[model samples]
Target: MQLRHFQNEFPYLVKALLSAKKAGRLSHSFLIHNDDGKLADDFSISLAQALACTNPLPDGDSCGNCVVCKQLEHRTYSELFTLAPVSKSRQIVIGVDDTIPDTMRWFRSLFHMKSSMAGGIKIGIIYDADCMNDESQNCFLKTLEEPPPSSHVLLVTANPFTLLPTIRSRCQSILLLRNKTSYEDEKIRGIAGIMWELMSSSNKISTAEECAFAMISISDNLEKFAEEKADVKWDRIFEDSKYLEPPAKKRLEKQHEAAISAEYLKMRDSMLSLIHSWSAQAYMLSCGIPRDSIANPELFPRDLNVISSIDPEKAYRMMRKSEDLLQILNWNVDTDLAFREFCMGVEFGK
Candidate 1:
């Protein structure tokens, strides 16, 4: 997850950052844009390490074995501060805030403290910076305008355009494009791989139940992950709220539920996007497109012979059907029912 790992994908950006670090011309604020959350966060850490590493390689990469690099890896670095959305049911939530929260206030207060470590530059990262409400974003502007002498502020967001123009003006922008090689979910990959296999199979689908099973497996895994995430957040949120009044507590509960649901829908849409891509590629193959030109070659079937028999019209229909299902899901249709109906229609409606 270091800059070196992404050299093949984002060579220009990596080279620029390295050159900046090497020349001592690093900007005080950086706004990195990427919808892929984990990769961006990891790159932020690696960037921070490069900026603060006591001993760096000639190419301005962190040695990774140095004390500062090791501290960052373990999240024990005193000079590093990370602000990401709070978790609600395994989903990161910036929350709907009219004003800044106590945590944000506390984070803002840290600039007053002198670095306890030898590293001169303290790194402050705001993960999902776009999630900040208007009030919080305005409050956060001060740091960008007049940051400490030896501090670097890194703002990471999937959608940079959501930020106020003033905020965007103050920082350098780096856009990280999606690459199939970077996708990491084994189960989703497995489901997608099996899905293409089934679609290309000569045997007609046997029953609605069989088609339902595939979608259900993906849904079940997502639900389980969400539940586990929610459980963790529940313990943390309720364990210390012994003094809240009944009405206030009820309001907080409702907000929490809303945030969880919002996050779940986001995840659902992302999964559906992957399915759409696979189906679109199938359509491409049906039109005699080369296999090498497919965006996600890893998820495609090993054999291309099935493409000869696939009706280009049917493949186009399947792609459109996936888009329609996505729209149906957005309307709050029951996921299982929408997916089942979509699957059955696509597989057997001929």
Candidate 2:
């Protein structure tokens, strides 16, 4: 997609980037973050095109029809080097002493090569950069600190906090609009249903206990879901590596475990965000806000009678509790215990 397509949604950001580029002040390195990975990916490509487009519009956006723009969109440009997690473990590793594709070493070698286009600049994009292991990140850090001339590196991630502070401090940070949690997953929708039941229940103690147990059960199911998805991915990798040495296979198993953990955490974070959004919306309803104005209006209690029964002060307190629950979950606290505490502490109804 071209930069102009995003102008309506990200006017300020698009304008600022184009203005900077026009003035020859664009940053050499950028850290672009967004909860929606696909959006970040598209935006990064658009930004790259804007910087390298041979034909730019009067508004300073890229002419999407240009050869350079088409090459960038297709990721076939000789000067564009891209790296992402391609392993079953979903990690970008510091490769073997010899360069291997998708590894940090290989990416560095390609990026540092003489520009394939005369007097052209190179663009290196590391999608899902947070998946880079510590060693890989450190190896990439050298490129960031002393980058090749006439080059730009874009580090794209949904979780920037996982990157080292040194790496973060070196790049210009661009955070895109975070899309709301998707309820398309049946498991997520089921969890939201349980939360709504807990909020609408009149018997606080009994409902809390029941909801806590249900939440824990669903949480366990989410882990299983992640494992099942990871297994499908690992099966292909395992089949290809059947001839590998035992030690190498063992390392692959460990990486598979990490991939499962990463998958589970992604789902769990979405679940938690939904919980927080529901509580905040409930508080808004209590304060006489229109249901249509709040986030995820369809996710709110549909019964008008139930909506009118919420106590403003109680709902506000519950919203605060949800925020605290989200914060505490980031620590090393026990997941089951945290859910139980959060469910028990929530207040609902008149």
Candidate 3:
């Protein structure tokens, strides 16, 4: 409904803004940090409304009845600039380009326009801020250094380490801690969570978490499955190799199949890497480190019981084997054999 959605943990962030409004201490820039996709996105949108709310509730959130709140909800507010990178297709995509989109145009025309709501703040939300190209970052740096009054720039990132130090130094970072409960690399744990919720329980999931888990499982096993058959390679040159080449005469068709296989294998290896990363993240998290810090704290909050029973070191060894399986399979090995080996060694095959 409003920023209240995050009232539990980071109630202080809102409280800080509200306090600032009372004491007038709002900063020009905020670097909102989190590894979680769900929270960071919501925080950015809520911050936008909170800064621009023309009416207020007693609890310090925007009054839904206000004109500014309506504009934000409908996404028609001119003051809000949500910039991300454009893909090669020039279509807007996340983490691809550096330019805060429309920053230049806003400066050009912004001076002539009146605030949509009286005495409202202009809000700029930049997701995937690390994707800024050199040119785009430079352009953004100009605006960031000379921020317009009554405007707040909230830059959201999962990987702030990859961003320029100059940019990092300029903004005030508000690290959002997530995974305070169970910790694993979010993506990989998500895969495991899907599996646990599905296979570990009889209840059904409407979102197909089971399907996602199976896809990830297959991907994780693919490389090891191929690697175990390192003794074999298929050559389509000889008469006996005709079947290996798939008798279709079209060269493009053959290439297409090869591309599909390549892509599939790459994805599979990614799952393996993700598993290793996730376990490591859990381990780290289990040790009481802030999940807010690392971009890839694969051991953030480990299953300490698993870590104690299996040990983090052993888990890491398992991760390496997963990686090895993925690598060896890429060289053209027997898929089923490699797969079986990995399944046998799931979490080091214990």
Q: List, in order, the clash count of every candidate structure.
A: 1, 0, 24
| Candidate 3 lDDT, 1-350, residue by residue in tens | 47777767765556666666556566778888687877888777776777778787665676765777888877787788676655664322323333334443343245224567566688877787766655556667766787766788888887554556567667866667675434332343455443223222222343334344464465565544444322133232233445654455456456545655674555554555554455444444444445554445343334544333334444444444444555555557875566445434443234
Error of 3 at 223 (Å): 20
- On TM-score, the stronger of 2 and 3 is 2
C-alpha RMSD values across all candidates: 14.6, 12.2, 13.4
Q: lDDT for model 1, on a 0 to 1 scale? A: 0.71
List candidate 1 segments past 4 Å from native: 87-102, 179-350
Top candidate when judged by TM-score against the true structure: 2
Q: Which candidate do you rate higher for TM-score, 1 or 2? A: 2
Better of 1 and 3 by lDDT: 1
Worst 10 residues of 1 by lDDT: 89-98
| Candidate 1 per-residue lDDT over residues 1-350, each given as its tens digit | 35787887766578878998789787889988776888887888888888878888998888888888888888888888777667453223333542444345556777547777654679899888877766668878887998876888999987655577688779876656465532355555665765565465543666445656777778767755555556577767776676889998898788777766765665565677677667767876787777776667677756767556667776776775675666566565688888777777677654
TM-score of each: 0.49, 0.54, 0.47
Most lDDT-accurate candidate: 2
**Of 1 and 2, the candidate ranking higher by lDDT:** 2
Give the Å shift of residue 277 in candidate 2. Answer: 13
